[model samples]
Target: MNVFILGLGNVGKALADTLRAQGHHVEGSTTTPAKVESLAQHVDKVHVLRGDESEKLAEASQSADVLVVCVAPDVKKTRTKEEREQHYQQVLEESCKSAANACQRVIFLSSFSVYGDGGEGQEPISESTPTANHDEPSSKYYQRAENHVLASSHGCVLRFPDMYGAPGDLSFSERVKMAIDYFGGNAIFGADAPLYAIHFEDVVASVVHAINEELSGIFNVCDDDNLPASNQQVFDAICAEHGWPALTFLNQIKAPNRKISAAKIYQSGYRVKHPDPNLQYLS
Candidate 1:
């Protein structure tokens, strides 16, 4: 199989490495030219281009059987609401457009932030759940991004929460420290909301499953087999352990408030390698 991955971040690089190890022809993209040599260790070919570079993407993905979009907004560049929305349009929405145009099969790595506190009821967030209707930039642009891919004949959208359990990713403690150092201990997520999350390996597996099964439509990809601790539970422990200020939630739930279900993907024969969120967290 010829696989082309956009945005060679932690997830994209992992996916590229996995696919390459499986004897597939893998091509990947990186915005930084300096990383091309490093990225070549994982992928057969590396294209240097931004996510919004449709022409370059189209050229690079010409022979690709699947185009997996793993582009993430640069957090350092997106501090304000306007900046975030614009960044999403470039990385998520525009990149999906380029992916759909370049490859017949499109798999998008999306965020559970699209669900945005979900509906009023206490039901678990499933594939059938209505997306966010509010103006939150991540939610709005991610929804738009999903639309572009789903418009194709064969498209898969795997929505995940904050992925952890990877050496390259920031630990829950580091995240709390970052919040304190940069954002004045304020958080966008609600304190009481359960932290719906997945392991880094499971995220890669889910994308591979989507490609192997030729899946279409939306699916919530997370560790649904085990219960999760709330933000308060995890953050409080991290703060106390580190002797840092506790994070203050804005009462805005960017993720699922109650529980998030991955039963749809499970029914499709995709099993999560790591299902316990409690084990994954530091707390």
Candidate 2:
């Protein structure tokens, strides 16, 4: 099969490499020309392209058996609430629309943030969970992207948790240090709320699984065994391991404060390599 990835970041690169190893012709796109040569090392071809460019995407992906949207807005590149919202919405919606036009099958990578705070209790979140916090800019943009994807018979949406295990991943230990440096023991993010995570390799595997099985609709792919532990607990554990002081938390009520389960995908024939984030809690 010929696979074309819209973005070639860590997760994208991983999937491209895997597909190539499986005897598929892989092509990837990058926003920067300098990265073209480097990205080509893992795939048959690389394109210098933009997600919102429907014509370019149509041309690049026309021959692809599957078009995967690995592109995500670089929130750091923009300032202001309006700018952030616009960037996210455009990148996601445009990519989905373009991918739908380009190929028979389109896979859009989405975040669990669509659920906002989560289920708030013990029950694991499924694909049907309410994507709360429609008030937030990120949620609004994600929903738009998701809607665009689901609108297509060939499109599918994968809802993932905080993806770790990438080279630049902000792991649990890193978050602990960040709390000390940035918040100065004042508080940890999602201090009192639940947090779920996914490994990068598993992310790649899930995509492959979906493509092989011709999956459609929305699916929540995340760790279930090593599920929701308050960021405060993990932070405290890591801080204690290093003899660091604890931070004060506001004890705020976060919406969508729920654990996510990948059972739907599992039953549909996809399984994650890492279902527990406890390993990060140690490191």
Candidate 3:
């Protein structure tokens, strides 16, 4: 099958690589010329697309069996709030239009952030859970994108959990560093807060399975473990793996409200390639 992946970010590139490795024709698009060359190393073709350009969007989306929208607004300090939101909304609209016109199946990369604070005791969030439009500026934009894709008849939305793994670029190491710097080598969260994550390899496998099966609908993609652990526990795991100092945990900190159940994807005969999140860091 021929697949076109829009937004050549970490996740998008991973998906393209996985598909190509499985003998599927894969094409990808990136906003940066440099990234285009990088992506070309993994897929058959790479198109440099300006996020605001409608023609590029149509061209990329119009000639594929499956279209995956993985473009996400940078949460880092690259653009102003309004600028970021406008760019994301425009990309969402353009991508959706292109996909609807050409692609038989569309897969959207969405975030569990749409679920917002899962509230106290919300152990494992399913596709049925009512989502909260997070108050955070970035999360709000993702929620809007999720809504746009799901409203389409041919779109499949994957509400991804916190994804982490190899390739360094997409790992949790940077996040660990940031937390340590901010909290003086300490991180905090409630003891019962459910923490969710998916390995990069597993993410790719799920996408491959969905495309091969032409699965449509919203599915929460996450690990089987829904048990909540403190930020300190996560930090310690990384620290121990990397031979660093363990961070302290503050009991007063509440866990972020986001956890997803991947049971639906599993029941669809999609097995995760990397079941253990901890093994991802070690590998």
Candidate with the larger lDDT of 1 and 2: 1
* Per-residue lDDT of model 1, residues 78-138, tens digit only: 6567887788788889899888888878999999888888769977888888898458788
User: How high is each candidate's TM-score?
Assistant: 0.94, 0.86, 0.77
Q: Which stretches of candidate 1 lie over 4 Å from their true place?
A: 275-283
lDDT of each: 0.84, 0.77, 0.67
Best by lDDT: 1
Candidate 3: residue 246 lDDT (0-100): 71
What residue pairs are clashing in model 3? 118-257, 193-228
Tens digit of per-residue lDDT, candidate 3, span 1-283: 8888887777788887778888989888887787666677877888887545657666766768788877665534323546646665666555655555555577887777666656556466778776664544445666666665667666788877667774755456667776567657655334344456677777777877888887888887776554444344565678887777776655332334545577898899876565545445534
Q: What lDDT score goes with residue 163 in model 3?
A: 74
Cα-based RMSD of the predictions, in order? 1.8, 3.1, 4.5
Name the regions of candidate 3 deviating beyond 4 angstroms. Answer: 78-104, 120-123, 170-173, 180-192, 225-228, 236-259, 275-283
> Between prediction 1 and prediction 3, which has the larger lDDT?
1
Best by TM-score: 1
Point out the worst 10-residue segment of candidate 1 by lDDT: 274-283
